[model samples]
Target: MLILTWVFVVTAGLALAYAAASAIGAWRWSVAARNLVAELTAGRVAPAASRHHAAELAGLPAPVQRYFRAALTDGQPIVTAVSLTQSGLFNMSAVADQWKPFTATQAFATARPGFVWDANITLFPGVPVRVVDAFVAGEGLLRPTILGLYGLGTLQGTGEIARGELLRHFAESVWFPTALLPSQGVVWQAVDDTSANATMTDGPISVTMLFRFGVDDLITSVSVEGRATTVGTATVLMPWECRMSNYQTRDGMRVPLTGEALYITPQGEKPYFKGTIDTIVYEFAP
Candidate 1:
């Protein structure tokens, strides 16, 4: 009986320690996300334009103008800040396409082009990986941890990482359409009638993507050439694409509720992320 009792106590202690570590990890992530959001908000640039006007769309590409007309109502207030929650499936294996479930919360500052995305991916039944992808003040960060406690990798700096994160911010502008307007540092060029090229520059990095509009005038897909993709310890340039769907009105803006991200690899298209927005909140320019 004493032996059994000791075994039970050891098992219980192990479980308790595991639970404590998990909780602490979660708390650390929360604190990091909060601090990053504060920095992004404080470092935001003052708006050059506050509201959307139909007349301003005349000079943009035809498809871009159509998109804006359908996505925003006249005199719509420009989005300055945004926060959203998302749930999705992320492909874990680069070779096998093993998909894992994930949940994430993201915050964005439009004026200065910054964003922080905090995500937790379930690698196994009880193992979760926390990933924080962010860009601020022309720098980028990508950190991943096991249960938010044991660091797997922490990537940060300028150049490719920064450019990649900026590209992500620009592509995700579909969720907050006001950020894509011509006045918001996005220059649109004609690419046929159903597609357009959007170029956004932040500091020394400039990224461009081809945006395809559907018949309903909603953005169907965004594709870019030569986005930095990390393969092992080395990062390589690869073609990337994000497909969006399930249009819905949120805060008087038409935005995609679902999205999938993929890499155009030599073997063909390899998707890495499939996500749906669970809830979103917007703060417009006053």
Candidate 2:
């Protein structure tokens, strides 16, 4: 009886220590996220008066110009930041064995190219897992915590991960139409009548994406070469694509409300993330 009691005491103490550590880690992460959002908000560039002018599309490819016209009005306010909610199925394995249903909320800042996504995955009847994926100020981080007590996994990096995340932010601009407008650090070149290439440079990171448009002048897909994808324990650079569909108007702008992300593997194309956007709210600098 005494031995059992002693074992119980030790186990309880260990669990307490783990809980305390997890709490501390979560607190630090929350504080860092808040500080990052504030810093980016303050550094946002002021929008130009001619941002929505038709003349601003002069040097852009014709298809790119048409996409702007289809997605935005003559004087839509440029979106500096956006908040959105999404529901989707997130795959847990590369073999497509397990898929978990999830709902997430994301905040994105275009001025500096950063985003914070928080998701809750339903894994069991009474328990849920929380995941956070974010890129801020040239840093990329992914953290998954179970029951707010134990961290399942964490991936944090700066160089390639940061660049890839920046590319992601640029591609996701499909949901924030005004973000694709001609900007100081952004340039568009024609690929063909159905496609264009966009190069976005933010500080030391420069990434380009090929944008494919449909007959209606809406973006159908965005593809990037040498994008990073995690395979096994190693991160591999590969061709990646995001296919958009279900066009709808949100807050006076046409945007894609549904999409999926696929990695073009040597074997074939494998799609991993699928999501439906429920709401999008734009925030502009005053």
Candidate 3:
């Protein structure tokens, strides 16, 4: 009886230590995230009207130029930073499994290609998961915790993951039309009458995406080659695409408020994320 009681005490002590460690880790993560956001916010500058000059649009393809004209006003302020709320369905598995509904709030800084997305994912009755996914200073991190105590998964890296996030930021530029201006990291090359190739570079990472516009001068789809995705335990480069629709004019800019992210594989295209933006607020330097 005494031995059993000692074993129980030891187990309980170990469990308490683990719980304490997890709590500390979570607190540190939150503090670091806040600091990163503050730093990005402090470095921003007000949007310059000169940056969106008509001359800059002269070199772009016709469709690309039309897209800029249709999406952004001539003197509209450039979106340096943005905060948005989104609700979506996220598929956790690739085997045609059920998709879990989620609501997320995100903040993005265009200059550094940094973003923080916090999501609440409902998997079952009374069981929900909190996910914090972020890309800061060329690092990508995804942390999902249950009940704020136990960690479900963590995928973090600086190479492939960071590249993937950079591509993601480029795709999401549709939501922040000013970021797609030629003055930004984006450079456009004519592909055809309705399509253009955009090369976006942030620091050492460079990615090219093909933008296809519809007759209305709205971007209908974006496709990127060599985007990274995780397959089982291996990280592989795959073709990825985002289909945009449901255009809405907000803050004097036309933007796609609904989109889906898909992975194009040899078998077929698998869409893993479908989201609708609820709100988008832009910020500039003071």
Best model number under lDDT: 1
Clashing pairs in 3: none
In the range 1-286, model 2's lDDT, one tens digit per residue, is 9999999999999989767775775576567557656765666666544246667888889999889889888767777788899999877767664778888888888776778887777777535577777777777777777754468867787888888888888899898877777753578988899999998877788889999999999999999888887888888999999999999988678999999988888888888789999888887645
Each candidate: how many clashes?
0, 0, 0
Where does candidate 2 stray beyond 4 Å? 1-36, 48-50
Root-mean-square deviation of candidate 3: 4.5
TM agreement with the true structure for every prediction = 0.97, 0.85, 0.85
What CA RMSD would you report for each candidate?
1.2, 3.6, 4.5
**Model 1 misplaced regions, further than 4 Å:** none
> Model 1 clash pairs?
none
Candidate 2: which pairs clash? none
9-91: candidate 1 lDDT, tens digit per residue: 99999999999999999998889888988899899977789998888898888888889999999999999999999999999
